[model samples]
Target: MAGDTPRAQPPPPDPDPGGHHPHLLFWRWRRNPLRRRTDRLHAWIALGLLLAVPAVAAAAMLAVGDTAYRHYRSAAEHEARTRDHRAAVLVHDAPRHPEPGSDEAKKARYPVEVRFPGPGGETRTGKTDVEPGLPADSTVLVWVDSAGEITDPPLTAEQIRSRTMGWAILAFLGVAVMGLAAHGITGLVLQRRNLAGWEAAWAVTAPRWCRLP
Candidate 1:
């Protein structure tokens, strides 16, 4: 019974190429005595960039979109509030101009002379754009400032969202371009290191092979 001690287990087989060789995702990270220092370093950097590129791109998209939304919202809100909209009557028939790709396949815009009441109830006249085929005496909403100068309407919520998204898309593409460039540069460096390692090993072993014959 005293001699019944458990037998010492044989050391586990080396995970090297001799056995069931599993294809590793990052072979350089695996424990191998022959792996060169620079080779290992390059592998680590490659892995880092693979993980970091997408993360940075997503972050840039969010950051850029948020910044653009804030700026556009502020400017649009101020402009919308400062601008005035009034009901105006057409004084003369709208000018007809044919437009390409319009649903009607013709003029989409008509430059009409419009008349509207000022703050003091006096009639004011100006040239404004309207839908084609509108006759004189038709009513339309006119956008203007306090000084009676015509201006564009404020940005709607949908428009703000679209503008922000567009800018974010551009930023995402830019990030992707930069990431690809970094990846390409790193790959070239890794190739150079690999070739240098091969040359060094060959230099040491070539003389030994010559002595064998």
Candidate 2:
């Protein structure tokens, strides 16, 4: 009988009777003899920051977006009122070829001389850029400001929306960064305080335990 191989042993039993993993979600808030006041404070602070960060970021984004939209809209309206389109006669033909190796050679539009009535009703001659192949005396429309100086057109609605969204996104990211920074700082401070508290507590308890036996 002793020469026969022994049967395999059974595994150890689980420490927890219910066979459930420890609950972590609100563990800091749960009542426990080992849980400290600092732990509770940390839990509350974490919860508050979790809720506050997105709320603040969203509010800042909306405020900045609205302000940017209004500012751009007002400027567009002003430009519309102060600008005009006028027909001008070309005094000469657009160059068939741009000067070799010149910056104009890379441009899609070519500058040519043109005559138009000024704001004072006097005939004025200035250079305006246009597509190539226009013959002399050809009439073309150009944007002119209140002073009759050639200028760019106003910002389109799409441009305004794009710019507004850009500013809003930047603001949202800025607020989120600040919130993260604040949370990190708070965590460092709390960690130091908790460590100090544990050290002090251990200093008091260690001597008593040492003297017991």
Candidate 3:
């Protein structure tokens, strides 16, 4: 029995059954009979999206942010030019009611009548919201336009900056969402095509491999 040669052992099982290393990037671009045209197209699409999404998002954010900042700053400057702060005296006591100590309550205002000097040096009376519980004849500062009408204070530099940042963030998020959606849709279409191709190839080869009588 010792005279017979031992049978040769089969080669060890391949760690990567597909013959492609797991660490390899862009393996679909490699020349292989198993790789299909759709595989290359999918790889190219993924590569383009990887490089394009961030660039497009940054551009959109900058463009929208610049436009918003300019518009807000111009409006604020115009308001500052046409409006002025003047001392006003309350005509009647401001009505007060009990409220919780919350941010909403802190910012709450009540309507009260006040008299202030007009642009022509004459006294003008108007209704405006002010802190509650103020006694009659209390002096307060109010913003008035050229026509002596009570108006809101002009936007500050901080407000303009915040508005610009908000718009920029929105633009960035919008572009990111669109890019992700496009990539997902393309992946689905390519996957379907790949499945169809595999099924057709298998249909042609199955009969040859299984020879019927």
| lDDT (Cα atoms) of all candidates against the true structure | 0.76, 0.79, 0.83
> Cα miss at 48, model 3 (Å)?
1.2
* Model 3, position 152: C-alpha lDDT score: 91
Task: Give me the candidate number with maximum TM-score.
Answer: 3
Segments in model 3 whose C-alpha atoms lie over 4 Å from true places: 1-35, 97-108, 117-126, 202-212
Write the residue-wise lDDT of candidate 2 on 1-213 in tens digits.
Answer: 433333322222223324265765566778877666766786788788879989999999999999999999999999999988888899999876556445665566788889988899888788899867679999988888898888788889999999999999999999989877877787678767767776666666655555533
Off by over 4 Å in 2: 1-26, 31-36, 88-116, 123-129, 132-139, 199-213
Q: Count the backbone clashes (under 3 Å) in each candidate.
A: 0, 0, 0
Worst 10 residues of 3 by lDDT: 6-15
**lDDT tens readout by residue for model 3, 1-213:** 433333333222223435377655556778876667876887798789879999999999999999999999999999999998999999999877477466676777899999999999999999889887789999999999988899999999999999999999999999999988998898678767777766676667655655645
TM-scores, all models, native as reference: 0.64, 0.64, 0.71
Which window of 10 residues has the lowest lDDT sum in candidate 1?
5-14
Give lDDT tens digits, candidate 1, residues 84-183.
8999999977755465457764646777889887767788888788987678899999888767766688888999999999999998889989987987
